[model samples]
Target: MKQHIRLLKTYLKPQRKRVVLLVLLLFGSIALDLLAPRQLSLFIDGAEAGASLDALVTVAVVFIVLTIAKQLVVAVAGYFSEDVGWRATNALRADLADHCLNLDISFHKDHTPGELMERVDGDVGVLSDFMSLFVFSVLGRALLAVGILGLVFSTDYRIGLLLLAYSLFVVLVLRRLQSVGVPHFNALRRTKADLSGFLEERLTSTEDIRANGARPYVMHRLSEHVENLVRRTRASMISARVFSSVLEISLAAATGGVFALGAWLLPGGSISLGEIFLIYYYTQLLSLSLIVITHHLDTLQKATGAIQRISELYHTTPQVRDGEGGSLPDGALDVTFDAVSFGYGEASRTLDEVSFALPAGETVGLLGRTGSGKTTLTRLLCRAYDVDAGAVRLADVDVRDLRLADLRDRIGVVTQDVQLFHASLRDNVTLFDATIDDGHIERAFAELGLSDWYASQPDGLDTVMVNGGETLSAGEAQLLALTRVMLRDPDIIVLDEASSRLDPGTERLIARATERLLKGRTGIVVAHRLATVRKVDHIVVLDDGEVCEAGPRERLEADPASRFSALIAGGTA
Candidate 1:
């Protein structure tokens, strides 16, 4: 509950004045409702005394005006509540995105993208409703009930006492029931998030599911999840609804008792006919308030569950960040790794005591087996993840000392897996940067040997690429990714077998493009193909996450003791 209050403060702090205004308006509305019964009682007494028609008309007009004002205030409060709710949701979503992007790589590895999406999107949506409805419903009704009870008690003690007793009983029972059912409803929310994540994962992989003839299997899993959600929802609804219905029935029975007692004591003049009517009206208002408040209590429960999930993402801190007062590097670039060691959680170290130095303007090849930590080393160069021990140096400064944007800007990467968003070809190449030069785009395509294919597209640069680059073949997507790096023209190049996806003819084009792209810039090529690696100025063989051999490509290939020599002989070089 404290956590929920703190979370709500973020929403309320932005609209403090509006919240105060809403409270004042609602108080006025409640005052009007309480005064309505008093005015009617006065009119009844005046009519019995044969008051003038003009006096009655005046009272009636005042009643109508007050009712209209009350309704107007309610409408305004509703509008403002919705606006505040939406703005809070926007703030929450933006903050969640920032946190998700900055979270530790280990967090991302543990949670699926779809699950995180459900937390940030689906869960936050529930909070929007809670913000808009919870306060308005609960506070407004509670105030109304208190005002009416006060008026009723002032008019007649006997009837007010009976009504108050019944109201307290109903509220206590309903609150207890709500408390018991909250945990169940919270469980229901978790199941719903799971359902959403499962559907999202399956839908995104629909092609693979169908191709492998696992449609029935997938459907069975989806059906089971849905059934579980339905069962949980049904049980929660039944318990809450049953408790609410029983409270209403008990209140009705108690109302009958109040009237009977009032009648029995009527001759003694403890209560009157008019006071009975007022009590009935007050009881109706109190019951209505209770019903609406209870409904939103359920909503509040769900929202709290959602807030818990969103808070998980909000609280996560990134493991890797810039050093104190970091800034971009300037001038000639040199990369050095000093006894750097790293590992995924609980797994064997992927890179162990690896030390290396590459002077500016040198091409280096990282030769290794499938799990030899080649890609991990490249990620460290970009500071994608910080090392577990030791330091990575760029231009004699620790990599962490450089601003993230500055570090990423100075390095260009093309990995084996190419991911393209759903956008125009030009957007993918320039990444929607407004200041990219047109000449750079043109030259990038030509340098990557993709100018002819790009020109043949329906709209050339403006042509739309479908989601995940599904419209283009795998090799074409790889070329587009390469063209993207070419346009950037960074000081350092990291190519993780970007040409492996292409055909033999396309491979030759990529090789020529690679040579042109690497000129006068430091490069790290992680490749399995012998022909592709042979072009680099130097090669370093990696085994079990350590440097095993190092020399020029030809010298390493000639040495029988070298791992690269063995890999070449095995046709996996």
Candidate 2:
């Protein structure tokens, strides 16, 4: 509860002025609404007393005008309320997105994109309802109920006391019911998130599912998730409806009791007809207001569940912290791994005591079999994960001692799996960096021998890549990835099986581009094919997380005992 209040206060602080104006408008509407009943009572009493027709017409017009004004005020108040709610929730959505982006790769590996979307968007959307309805439905109705009670009490003490006591009883009972329903709502949210994640995964893998003939199994799994979600949702709804029914029945009984008491008092002349009518009107008003409040209470319970989940996300601390260290030096930077050892969680070390170095302006080929730590070595250089022991360095300075953005900006990586968004070709190459101009893009394409490919597109850079780059072939995607790396112009480059997807024709083009791209720059090529690394200055071969061979490529290839030579001879490179 404290956390919920704190979050509300933090988000509401920026919209304080709008909130204040909304409150004033609410009061105006409620005050005007309450006046109608009073004027109706006046007209009733006047008619009974044989008052002037003109005076009665004046009261009738005033009553109609007040009702219309109250509606207009309510409409305006609702507008302000929605405005504030959207702004606050949108701000929260942006914050969640930024926080998720800053989290480490391990965090992303543990959570799917769909689950994160639910957390960042779906949960915040629930809070939007809570904010918009909170003012009018919750607070306004409560205030209106109290005002009705006060007006009734001024007319007759006995009836006022009964209604007040009934309102209190209803509120207490509903509060207890909400406490019981909250856990169910929380469970429902979890199941819904799971369902969303499953759907997203299945949708993205539709092709594989069909190709592997696993559609039936996938459908069965999806049905199980849907069943669980339905069960949880039904349970939450049942609890809410049960409590709401109780409130409705209690208010109905209270209304009957009020009317019965007013009848007995009216006959005895203990209260005037006008006074009895006023008391009955206020009683109905109070009952309706309480009903609205109860409904809002149910929504509040759902929002409470959302708030708890969102708060948990906010509390998740990234395992990898950003460094506040200085920037890297300009020009080609040497890459070094000093006896580094690291693993994913409790798993055995992926890279165990790995030590290697590539001098400034030198290119090295990292040769290894599957699961032999070649890719892990490149990941360490990029600071995807901190070393379990020892340090990774650029230009003799520990990578950990450099700001995360600065370190990543100095090292460019191009992996086999090229990720292109559904955006314009220019946006894909520049990654939406507005600072990169057309000249840089043109030069990158020309230097990579993609001038003909660029010219083939009628729209040129403005051409939109759709379906995650399905518009381009595998080789074309690789070329685009290379162009992205070239445009960044980083000091050090890491190519992890980047050329494995290209055909012979494209491979030759990329090889020339790679050689030209490595000029005066440090590079590490994690090669699966020997031909790709034949021209590299040196080679480092890893076996089971340990480097077994390291030296000039010519020397390593000449040595019969060298693992690099054995792998080459065995045609496994």
Candidate 3:
């Protein structure tokens, strides 16, 4: 409920003027409708009193004028309501999209893309219906109901009492129905999210399913999700239909009772024929008003479910954020890990009191087995997650004290898993930066020995790479990833060197490009091949996050007692 109100406040504050105008238009339209029946009553009485044809003509003309005025007001109200509703929803969706992009990486780890998309898309759709119809309908019906009751009372107190009692009963029924609807709709919405997440996971892993011939298994799981979704939807629809039925029946009962009572009172001269006729019209108007109220109630119930879903996302705070009054150094680079110990929650430490330092402009090689904390160390350098304990510093300034952007701007990372978007090659290389010209892109590609590959493509730099397309081979893809990082040209580079088996020719090419890219720049290479270590200035051997040995590569390789020498002798390098 709090979340729903928060979302409403965001849109309502911006659209208060439109809301007010819509209210005025609805009141005017309903007033004209209620008054039109009264005018007809006067016409009927004039006819019974032997009035001339001119009197009937004047009454007819007034009725036509009132109807036309009401229609014009209604049309304008509908147009403005829709205009404000869509505009407000668009603004909200934009804010949600922006928030998703800036959220912490761990947030993505916990949520699927489809779930987020549904919150932004489906949830906003729910809000749109309420803003466009339910909100305006509620205001219009309230004014119409109150005015009609007051008008009825002016004519006959007994009739007014009867109508008011019936209206309260109908209202109570609708309110109870809504109370039941809220929870059911909320259940339906959760099922929708589940279906979305399930479908997304399957689509992303379609190739694996096909390769493994697990079609039957996947189909069965999808069928289960679909069945659950259908059940929830059916239940919600049944509830709505039942509520509408009750409202319709109650309206019929009230209309009949009003006629019976009016007939009895007319014999006592408590009401005239024209008054009885107008009372019937009032009862019909009340019925139509109740129907509209029921319809809007269903819409409001659906929106409440949606609002609850979206609010959950907006309320979540990211685990990672910028530091207080922090700034980056304006120098080459000096990275140090002072007794750093880190882990994922409650798990064994991935990095345990690991300490090391690299002077500015020096290249170091990090050798470790899988899960030995090589990538974890690079993640720390980028401040992807805060350290569990100890400190990582650059140029004697604690990383925690540096502004997030400034800290990340000084470092570049190229992981083994390279993800490319379905966009033009130029966009991928420059990361959509308008300031990076073709010449700069060309230089980055040329430096990485990818100029020929780019030139061979039919569209050159403008060619689109499909998502997950093997447009570039393993080595070529690694080279392009290098080009991406080189475009940033940060002071520190962390390379999770590719483990793909490269031919002699491709190996030599990568070695040369790697040397050139690391020249006079501080670098840490998560080395996969033994030859990669020989070229580095220093070597750090890690075993389960703890540093086993650290020294110049030649010195470590020469020491028989060293972990590096033992691994070399064991032919595990």
Give a tens-digit lDDT track for model 1, residues 1-573: 576668779877888888788778777777877777666666766676788999988877887887888788778878887877888888988888788977766777877777788788878888888888855587778888878778778867766787788778877886787778877887887788778778878888888999999999999998999899999899788877887688778767766876677677668867665666667777778878877876776676677678877776676677787666455455437888899999876568899999888887888888788899888999898887999999988778788887787888889998878878888888887889868877778888777666787777898777898765357777677677778888878989999977766789777767777887888788999887777787787888788999887777788788888777888888885
Instruction: Tell me each candidate's TM-score.
Output: 0.91, 0.95, 0.90
Which is the better candidate, 1 or 3, if ranked by TM-score? 1
Compared with the true structure, all predictions reach lDDT values of 0.79, 0.87, 0.82
Residue by residue across 136-206, what tens digits does model 3's lDDT show? Answer: 48767767888888988988998899889988987788778888998999998878887898889988899
Rank the candidate models, highest TM-score first.
Answer: 2, 1, 3
Stretch of 10 with least lDDT, candidate 2: 466-475
For model 1, where is the 10-residue window of minimal lDDT? Answer: 323-332
Which candidate order results from sorting by lDDT in descending order?
Answer: 2, 3, 1
TM-score of 2: 0.95
Task: Itemize residue pairs with steric clashes in candidate 2.
Answer: none
Task: Encode model 2's per-residue lDDT on 456-480: one tens digit a residue.
Answer: 8879999998754358877777778
Highest TM-score scorer:
2
What does the lDDT read for residue 57 in candidate 3? 87
Error of 3 at 115 (Å): 1.6
